[model samples]
Target: MPKIFSLFFLFVLLISCDEDVLPKPKAYLSLEYPKKSYKKLPLKRPYTFNVLKNTTIIDDKNNWLKIKYPTLKASIDITYRPIQNNMKELLTEAEKLVFKHAVKAEQIIPKDFVNTKNRVFGSLYEITGNAASQLQFHVTDSTHHFIKGSLYFYAKPNYDSILPAVAYIKSDILHLIETLEWKKSI
Candidate 1:
């Protein structure tokens, strides 16, 4: 009986060994984002810009706004400042906010935007890796209006997982910057 059992075990082992063990390839989620449609935000702040029609705008006091993407679990926090001869200081503050995530960011790539016709000038900072904020930007008219915006996710910072959403929103941000206009008063 023991010999028969050993033969059965050996037969099973030989059968299993016929196929080489192979590692399964890693998989990622296949995300499908909606086709974008944009319109001007209906708020009477010091500034105006186009936002994704799918987003919900939450207007806070003092010209601060939260552009929420509930489906995507993200939001762009916007803070508006009236430049009172403090352009240098404001630029420093915006850079500080971007670099604060440097400890967690693998890289920070900055792209500058200058639209002299629209009187808009700014820099967009893209933060790679597991940083808290994936994107940050600051735009100004150099004399009267300045705004700083940051992109944040509601979940834990996993750069790889959130990259698609980041990309989608980044285009929306670019549109906003392109359409950005400042008013003399709100």
Candidate 2:
């Protein structure tokens, strides 16, 4: 009986000689987004752009718009201001709103867009980190029309978790900028 017990203990010890157990790294949600299809924003406004077919446009006073993505629990809030020789002020205000997230943002990257034929010149600012807004942009004809947009998620900012969704919407925004047009000079 003593010999059998020693053999059993040795077998158990050998079997258990393994690497230390480690906790798993965090797992992120595997999100699948719909393919991109866009149509004219079905609303009459001073400015117009192509919006993702999946979104809902909530028109507000002063020609403001909330382009809502219900499935993603996010929206792009857009505000339009007609330029009255106040381009400098409008540009400053837009930059201010983008930089406001700097307190929590790891970085702010600005990309300038210029389409002389469309008279659309703008800057898209991508904020990286757990900021309230992940993206902010401003486009203008530089004389007649000015529009600013900010992307927001309904949930508290979780940079890692929301990064994929942000990238998806960022593409849509780039498309919007590409297709933006003014109905007429104000």
Candidate 3:
């Protein structure tokens, strides 16, 4: 009976000596995506740009493209529109599409891009916060071709959780813009 009592006392002492229970500080996920490699997506589209090596093309019809990154649960949607007599309207709609996210976005940043030699001038938007899309861009020759691309993740829109992927994919987008040239421009 003495031995049993001693064992009980020892167990109680050990359990009670634990450190105070404090809540853990918040930590975002650490996602490491592969370094980007430029590969002309094997599509007969009018423009060609270096994209990530592992990007899987989902659709390449009528100049519309869907690049999928299943591992990252993200996709880039490319929409091509012929500039009818309405470049103004197209720009308005693209800007509207991006601004619509302002309801859920902390802020929307616009960065202008121009490549006069290639005649590829455009604007890229980085929508911060819990928006459905983290990045979007609209590029055109102002007379013939207009393309809008947006990046969306399949998972919930938590920018903090998927920031690593956003930064990595953003580099690829910049590469594409830098290297983009319309067949007509050629």
Candidate 4:
């Protein structure tokens, strides 16, 4: 009788231990994203702006595309060719735009230019409002056969809010510049 009671107690202890040994609840880690969708708008000019096909616009007229990583809180603006048409003129126009908005603007040196697989690119810093953000632009006149590209994140005035998205979206910008197709002038 004593031996039987001891065995039953041991069996109960083993069952309790087994119940406690459940597989650690599956650990899951993921980023949170907003519900988003994009539509192709009719190109009003000869230029075409192609987004990731997954972006969403809070408004079409404002040209705001909800960024994929909301933590970055970013949007892309694809402005068509303004009056300035050539690369030189475009650069000058861009400089003017930056200076107009920035309390201070500085042109980066050649050492700052980063050589990627295809194009040479540099960043210009502009301090506007109370914060400073980067104005990074890359040009590939050789491939596109014409001067064409974009000024990005112009609406983002906060450096902290804009920098992360700028960094994340830069690869996409490089891809866009790499795969650019120029409309041949008839």
Q: Top lDDT: which candidate number? A: 1
**In model 2, which residue pairs have backbone atoms overlapping below 3 Å?**
none
**Model 1 bad stretches (over 4 Å):** 1-28
Candidate 4's residue-wise lDDT over 1-186, tens digit each? Answer: 999999999999888886545577886544444343333433333323344445543333422223233345445444434233466666676556555545543433211344465343433332423333344343433333223233345353655455445544656555544443434441
Give Cα-based local distance difference scores for all models.
0.96, 0.95, 0.89, 0.43
Among all windows of 10 consecutive residues in model 4, the one with the lowest summed lDDT is 62-71
- TM-score ranking, high to low: 2, 1, 3, 4
The reply for model 4, stretches above 4 Å from the true place, is: 1-50, 57-73, 82-88, 101-133, 136-156
Candidate 1, residue 32: the lDDT equals: 95
- Candidate 1 C-alpha lDDT tens digits along 96-126: 9999999999999999999999899999999
Better candidate number, 3 or 4, judged by lDDT = 3
CA RMSD, predictions in order = 3.2, 3.1, 4.9, 10.0
User: How much is the lDDT of residue 72 in candidate 2?
Assistant: 94
Number of the top-ranking candidate, with TM-score as the measure: 2
Question: If scored against the real structure, what TM-score would every candidate get?
Answer: 0.86, 0.87, 0.83, 0.43
- lDDT (C-alpha) at residue 52 in model 4: 47
lDDT of 3 at 130: 96
Best-to-worst ranking by lDDT: 1, 2, 3, 4
Give the lDDT of residue 180 in candidate 1. Answer: 96
TM-score of 1: 0.86
Candidate 2 vs candidate 4, TM-score winner = 2
